[model samples]
Each structure stands twice: as structure tokens, then as C-alpha cells.
Target: MILIVASLCVQILCAIHVIRSSRNQIWLLFIMLFSLLGCFAYLMLEVLPQHWNNRHVRTARAQVVGKVDPERAVRDAQRNLDLAETAANYIALGDAQAIRHRYADAESAYRKALAMGPGGDWGTQVKMAGVLFERGESAEALRLLDAAPELGMGSERDRRALLRARILADLGRAAEARLLFEDVIERIAGEEARCHYVAFLLQQGDRYRARSILEEVERRAKRMDLTQRAAQADMYRWAGEQLAELRKV
Candidate 1:
């Protein structure tokens, strides 16, 4: 009896999702006529694919993979690169390598990408800038970002600003860096930009502002799901630590 109730519940939920999401009317018939099999089909064919393609869902999956098997990403990226030396594959390898802090390997991969078919390309350039920045080649990173003065408009453009701000901070260009960081933080809804600003504020000895920003981040985090929180665990940990210390002062 319990199993039957649960099965009906699933079919009803699937039907609700089908209606709410405006999925094909055929799916409703399938769910109503085929029972559990129909619900499974709708989920696998319709729902799961949609969620899997979402960037947040993809990031969540990547975070889980990184936590469970960090080395697998690098290996998988290399396997893909081995299959095709295309720019996208190389960039994927660079990203995997960068995550492992293998800056030399990442840089080599990015260089190969730059030499290949025009990437999702400027994005590749920005990724290379990140690798260069991580490797302490701040000057080169700045040059790459500067070369592409017009990034049109997107996350990458915002990323460019955030990255440039970090590079400037590293170069002792505090005022310029602060302006860039503030611009990106205020305009973008990304926690990373805000976290970077938090770190920057700490370095500048403005603990008060850092605490305020982190408090805001913490408040915003209340609404996030487990995977989203897990994906940002490091930043959240650091933010918490900073907040605790600031409270002491």
C-alpha cells in the first residue's frame, strides 16, 4: 500500500512539473498511462537533462567530483585532450590543470589553445590570464586582459575585472584595485567577486568593511542548497574565519 501511494505521488509530481514547465502534452499521457515507467522516462528524458545542463548544477556536480576524486578531473581532461587537440579540449585541460595548481602545465595547455582554432577564445585568453596570475606572472596577465578591452558583456567580462583587481592589488596598485573590486562586487551577484573583495579589504586593514561584506555573504548563503554551499565551502570557511577574527577586534 505504501509503495502504491509513493508511486502515485511520483506520477502526480511529474505531472505537476510537466504542466508547470510546459513540457510536451505527450509526456502527461505517458505518465498517466505507463505508471512508474512513464515517470522514470519523463525524468530521464526531460527533467534530469534540463537540470544537468544548468551551470549551477554542472558546478555542483564538478564540486562533488572534485571532493570525491580530485585527480579524476585532470585525468579525464587529459583523456579528452588526447582524443582531440581542439582549443576547447585544451582549455578544458588547462582548467583541470589550473584547479590542481599545475600552473606550468595549465599555461602550456592554454598556449596550445591560443594557437588552435579560435576558442570560445577570449574566454580562453581570460583563463590563461588566470593561470598566469596564479603563477605570479601578473604583468602578462594584465596585458592579456588589457588587450581585449571590449569583452562585450558577460560573466567573463566581470571575471576580467575581478582578476585585474587582484593583479593590481598584487602590484601595489591599491587604489586602482579597490575601484575595480568595488565596481565588480556592486554590479555582479557572484560571491567570488565579493569574497575576493573581502580578502582585499583585509589586506588593506579595513576589517570593518570586510566583516560587513562577509555578513552579507552569510545572509545570502542562508537560501542556498547543500551543493551550492559545498561548491563554495572554501570561500565560506575563509569568510567565517575572517568574521570570527574581526569580531575579536
Candidate 2:
């Protein structure tokens, strides 16, 4: 009896998900006609794949993989690069190498992408700048970002602004960096950006402003559901640690 009740519940939930998802009429027919197996199949094949593709789920899966083989990402990226030498694949290889702190390898991959692709490759340039910045080549990072074609609106622009700000900060151009950081924060208000800005403020001896910014990030993060928080786990953890350190001060 319990099994029958649970199966019925599954079918109802699957039907609701199908309706919400606008899946094909065939799936609805399958759910209606094939009973328990149909509902289970639909949940396994359809609903779960959608959930798994979510950013948080992908991050969690990557974390699990990272634990097992720290170098797996670099290896997988190389295999993909071997299969397809496209600009996109090279970018992926660069990102994977960057994660492993292989900045020289990452820089080479990004440069290859730029050389292989046509002119005005904004993404490749920006990625190369990131690797340069991480490797403490701040002057090169600034030059790359400045020379790249004007990234059009939205996230691309904000990303370039943030990187430029960081490079400026590293180069002792505090006023310029502060303005750029403020503009980026006003535009996107992303956690990573806020945390970075807070660090900048602290470095500049503005603890009050840093504390306020950190508080805002903490409040926003606390309000997110588990999945949303997990998607931003790295930034969230950074913000949390920064906030804790600030409180201690």
C-alpha cells in the first residue's frame, strides 16, 4: 500500500513538472499511460538532467571531482584540446590550466586562441589578462585589458572594469582603481566584486566602508537558498571569511 501511494505521488509530481516545463505531449501521454515506470523514467531522464545542468550542481560536481584528482581538469582540457583545436577549446584549456595555477601554460593557451582566431577576440584577450594578473604581471594585465576591443554592454564590460581596477590597484593607482571598483559594484553588485572592493578599501585604511560593504554581501548571501549559495560557494566563503576577520578587528 505504501509503495502504491509513493508511486502515485511520484506520477502526480512528474505530471506537474511536465506541465511547468512544457515538455512534449508524448511525455504527458507516457506519464498517463505507463504508470510508475513512466513517472520514474521521466524524473530520471528529464527533470534530473535539468537540475544537474544548474550552476550550483555543476560546481558541487566539480568540487567532488577536484577532491579525487586535482589534476583531472587539466588532463581533460588537454584531451579536448587534442580532439578540437578550436578557439573555444583553447580557451577551456586556458581556464583549466589557470585553475591549477599553471599560469604560463594558461597564458600560452590563451595566446594560441588569439592567434588562431580572427581579429577583435575580446574574450581571449581578457582571459589572458586574468592569467597575467594572477601571475603578478600587472603591467601586462593592464595593457591587455586596455588594448582589447571595447567590450560591449552588460557582464563583459563589468568584467573588464573589475580587472582594470584590480590592475590599477596593484600599480598604486588607488584613486582610479577605487572609482572603477565603485562603478563595477554599482553596475553588477556581485559578491566577488564586493569582497574585492572591501579588500581594496581595507588596504586604503577605510575600515568603516569595508565593514559596510562586507555587511551588505553577508546579508545578501544569508538570504540565498542552499542551491544559490552553493553556486557562489567560493565567493560566499571568501566573503564569510573576510567578514569574520573584520569582526575580529
Model 1 CA deviation exceeding 4 Å by range: 1-57, 118-120
Scored by lDDT, model 1 comes in at 0.88
Clashes of each: 0, 0
**TM-score for candidate 1:** 0.76
TM-score of every model? Answer: 0.76, 0.76
lDDT tens readout by residue for model 2, 35-128 = 8889878878877888988877787777778878989988888899899889888989999999889999999999998899997887788889
lDDT of predicted model 2: 0.86
Cα deviation of 73 in candidate 2 (Å)?
2.6
- Cα lDDT listed for each candidate: 0.88, 0.86
Cα misplacement distance, residue 74 of candidate 2 (Å): 1.7
Ten-residue region with minimum lDDT total, candidate 1: 117-126
The runs of at least 3 residues in candidate 2 whose Cα sits more than 4 Å from the true structure, single-residue gaps closed, are 1-50
**Model 2 per-residue lDDT at 7:** 74
